[model samples]
Target: MYTSQQPAIAVDGQNRIHIVWSSYLPIGNALYNIFYRMRNSNGLWGPIETLSVFPNSYHNYNPRVAIDSEGNVHVVWEAYLANEYYPHIAHRVKTNRGWSEVVVLQSSYRRENPSCAVDKFNNLQVVVTTNEIGPSYDIVRFVRTPEGNWEGPDTVVHFNTGSRYFPEIVATPDGNLHLFRRDFGHYTNYCYRIYYKRYKILNYVILE
Candidate 1:
């Protein structure tokens, strides 16, 4: 069982379970790292693996996981790159050999609260909030095509002139996408609502 402020879990067809979480360890002052654990089909959990061992002063959080049809595990999280003021999205994959190298998805944006899902075609869809510019926020999506290529500079899912945060996304059984986010209205000071929207991807067309 993994415990942290942010946690994510995914299961494969073989009943192999994977979990990722953020843990803060005090080296000199305080620092955090993303640790991972897995449960085999026999119900035995492997030892915790330190996925990121950054410096003791940096902060790491908001870990998410997704598993594809071939049983490859993908993980994404928010972390501060060396000599950077803002956090960026970092990704990794698990294979029969071992965990692959950490890949940085977005370097310029202050990204956080990332969640990922794999489509039926084994394409990876990731959604996260960014605060690279001003007070408002934007939701960005990255799709890894089945051809083993990462598509685009990240499509904008939602953009708000007002404040927005905490996005959750899921791929539906019907090949559609569902997204939920916290919305803060501008005029109605007393009205804060959570909004839900559905997106359909048919013939490679993303329809709202």
Candidate 2:
């Protein structure tokens, strides 16, 4: 029996379906970690694989995955830091060899609700919500360069009155990035509207 939480999916160049999700253990320290599995295009499901290597007592959830042009899998998830209350973004890559160690991506404040995509150039892009300034959460982005290095905590969108959450991204062949998020003005308001924006992939610089 397979049970999981916060499941995400992506497709590789070979059309193999890849999935990542969180799973909790019943015994010992009551630990939770991210698990990964894939289904071949030929109609076969592979073995289950645990991605996160965090120690016991920590939780890893809200996973998102993007498969690059080279068939390498990039995954990002949110987890509470040890001895800390705030949540941090964790990332890992699944190469030909196997899943790499989970790496914490730096941010000015705690991050929550993350999404990711791979551009035509095979560069990985991620978006998340952070309450860096005050009670309001802003949409921020992280990008991976051609050299396999990461850059930015770039501000994708910001609002003075409300908090932003649950960001998603999509990259097009023409080098365009489309970002979407949920905004809230106050706790009393549901908003119920989807906020959206589009920008050039090379530079997220606002036209203003």
Estimate TM-scores for all models.
Answer: 0.85, 0.88
Q: Which of the numbered candidates is closest to the native, going by highest TM-score? A: 2
Pairs with steric clashes in candidate 2: none
> Among these predicted structures, which one has the highest lDDT?
2
Candidate 1 per-residue lDDT, tens place, 1-208, comes to: 3346677888889988999988875333336778899999999999988776534236678898988878888888887765578877777788788887776765676788888888766788888887664556767677876555666445555454665668888886688888887767673373777877888876345677
Deviating ranges (above 4 Å) for candidate 1: 1-3, 26-30, 54-57, 132-135, 146-148, 187-190, 203-205
TM-score of 2: 0.88
lDDT of 2 by residue, 97-180 (tens): 987777787554789888999887788888888887565778888887656688878788876777788999998888888888
Q: CA lDDT of each candidate?
A: 0.74, 0.78
Q: What TM-score number comes out for model 1?
A: 0.85
Per-residue error at 41 for model 2, in Å? 1.1
